[model samples]
Target chain A: MLETVATGHQAKVSAERGAERSLLSQVPLLSELPVQDLTRIEQQCRYRRFTADELIVDRDSPSTDLLFLVRGQVRIVNYSMSGREITYEELTSGAFLGEISAIDGAPRSTGVMAIEDSLVLALPRSVFLDLCTRYPNLALKVMQRLAAMVRAAQDRILDLSTLAAQSRVQAELLRQAQAHRNRPNAAIIEPIPVHSDIASRVSTTRETVARVLNDLARKGILERCKGALVIHDMRRLQSMVSDVRG
Target chain B: MLETVATGHQAKVSAERGAERSLLSQVPLLSELPVQDLTRIEQQCRYRRFTADELIVDRDSPSTDLLFLVRGQVRIVNYSMSGREITYEELTSGAFLGEISAIDGAPRSTGVMAIEDSLVLALPRSVFLDLCTRYPNLALKVMQRLAAMVRAAQDRILDLSTLAAQSRVQAELLRQAQAHRNRPNAAIIEPIPVHSDIASRVSTTRETVARVLNDLARKGILERCKGALVIHDMRRLQSMVSDVRG
Candidate 1:
């Protein structure tokens, strides 16, 4: 919905602006901007809220404003004609969406749905483009972000081209394992990553994931703990993935 | 090679700059720049030439200069650990590459090889970023170009997720046929499109492509007219692709 909710009170507006200023500071794209510039941007930003599972943006829609995730989570997804939902990526608080269409004046390529109650700040396309031009550093940052995105897509393409469905699942596990490693003190965090989510990520059916996990469990490699799979032989799992992935 | 070749004759430089001005005008990212600005950019641009089968850019290379294809053809490719080459995309004249790293300061995601004897104009990242900041339209164009890349990747991802090998091959054919239709009077262009190229594009084995083509010919859907397959059943072919691709 494009409709904006009016600000509550002047005092509350002041408090929210302060909180927003801090939140905007954490956003990779806007973090480089000065506090004054951030405040300026905050003033022009329009706010909206979406409920859980609400469709925020539809694929091929004409909406072009960049949505900054102020709170909650959203998933970028597109459904095939057969009604198969392909989840592309998920963004939590601080990540932004719709910049592609916002800059290019094109329709949205993928739809976005709020995973939970999400609050977003909609910055007009003109204002964002103006800010990018006004700051070369910001423009460079934007380019870097886009570059990262291209690399990610290239990685996915490589996986699809080089590996089969089973190898892809292992590679997906390795990727999550690496992400887990990167997080400080995440080692004891058991039962992580939903199997269905893993299936979607590897572009395979949940049945395949269940079979893989069960096979691994029989071999004393990994086991399912409650809602998630736990990797026991991490090195063996890595080798199994790299052996086929390579 | 980062080394620049010394200019031969003053008259030659003067003549080439004029041609370069017009050529720069055709580049979508730089087209919006004024004649004078294009000239200025042309002055800073360095020229390089590569022989057929020469590696122009290597995957994960630290070099980061945007290369504008002035003449001939090039292909972006990456190899699996087993040494199987997967061709990503091919570009001819008036196209460019290396912008992802040039903007982001990241390593190249894929390697570029010269398909034939080709010439390129290399623009330094700093100068390109400066021009982008100076001209919002140029930056907007840059974003649009990047957006186009993202959309292309997303489309590929969708195909990978929803379609199997056979469907992908058919989809690729449909894509090529559409591209053929878009070209003015390309109907008489029989014996076009090498089969090996088709295999590379769909990320499948050449044997699979051969089998699919043979099946289509047996069914009188498409026939191999010497070097290329002439698609006789266009509507049926499209419908077959959509039925699966959807």
Candidate 2:
């Protein structure tokens, strides 16, 4: 059954039934569902793959599917009226997209693109909503996720509005570090997008980001290794943000 | 029944039963509920009044109730690490507050304060969630409201990131204008919250907001009345934002 369902692109083959079910179980909202319910959900999902830079959803287009990344990473962004891209967020595997539009049936407000070769399980909006309605816990989980997103956005707004340019860069770096933190007291953010990408995300110029990173490296707070940026002093970085915010 | 529910100072007396029901009917989330359901919801609510500058909800406090403003206005804001106030949003009559916390059971992330003598109907969070679970349409309506808020926040992020200081001010003004626009081609933003308040909302300095408003006035695009700023040329204001955005 698994092989039959796996189609195209041997580069990133679809997961077998057991693997897919395990993947679904890893999702916070679906984690506690009974096996029967998980199977039902798995039946509704279709696996799809995208190469780097592939557009998954276009802003303002009808949002018809909920996408759960199973492999690789993606970027969520919006283009300004002048065509400047503003990165709203980035998602890695185990993260889902399109909850806002899926709940309200609104057109997509941001464009999502694969940052690397990615695999995702796509569930139609109707099926997702049905699942939420049928499972009260699912509805609560969805609401919790949305609430957390709202709080994160509010914090971003605060940072953009009040923090200075250097502070903004540090703040974003710290945020990314925390998200990817694996060590108890340190964080390694790999393939650190690009200075330009970081600038856009923090509403600063690329030069500013470059200058800030260089300063941090000189101060022994951060180090650049191969394809990643490592934060050596998380406490110092946090204090810097607090000072700027103050 | 209405009289019994009205407590504390009654400079603005509690609304009559018929009037209370009518007001609930006006709320988008409760508008379509059956009369019996509406009455049940109404029964669970109690009227409260806040004097100008009263704190409605404290930041980081446990969220205990959902508030529906029946009269006057409130501002949602967060205090920076330095004690600088940053306005996140403002709500007026017909708007409800605390749905985010009510849904997620998280602490209130921002403080809400009354800008004037205000009347509100308060519903306990547990009851509100119960209502949502029992009424699917009610739950959908709540979800729709949250979705709209998420989209608005995304737009704000875009504006703050890409627009110039002056453009940011103009964009926020245009947004507020549209929300309050009563006539086809005009909008009257009354008691235009102080310049500093507007500055915080748009992430600009008070001096910048004053300068932008002065420029608009000099260009005949806006006129200041006793307690309001009247947009004489809505199209012109709209175009100003579009031009900056573009």
Deviation in Å, model 1, residue B39 alpha carbon: 4.8
Could you give me the TM-score of model 1 versus the true structure? Answer: 0.87
Instruction: Look at candidate 1 and tell me the lDDT of residue B124.
Output: 92
Query: What is candidate 2's lDDT per residue for B2-110, written digit by digit as tens?
Result: 2223544332443443444445665666776788777677667777767788887888898567788878899988877767777877888878888888887779878
lDDT of 1 by residue, A122-213 (tens): 88888888887788777767777777777888888888888888888877776776665533322222456777878877778888877877
Report the lDDT of model 2 for residue A73.
94
Q: Which CAPRI category fits model 1? A: medium
Give the DockQ (C-alpha) for candidate 1. 0.57
TM-score of every candidate: 0.87, 0.83
Tell how far residue B125 is off in model 2, in angstroms.
3.4
**Candidate 2: tens digits of C-alpha lDDT, residues A1-246:** 111225454214423433444456656678768978876776677777788988888888885687788788999998887778888878888788888888888899788989998877778899988877777667777777777778878888888777788998998898889988888668999886599899878877899999999999999999999998899988899889888775
Candidate 1 per-residue C-alpha lDDT over B1-246 given as tens digits, one digit per residue, 9 for 90 to 100: 433544664336458656644556657677667888877886678777788888889888997888888787999888888877778789998888988988887788899999998877888988877777788777767777788888888888888788877888888877777666533322212456666787777778888888887777788777667666577777787888878765
Error (Å) of candidate 2 at residue B106 is: 2.5
* Pairs with steric clashes in candidate 1: none
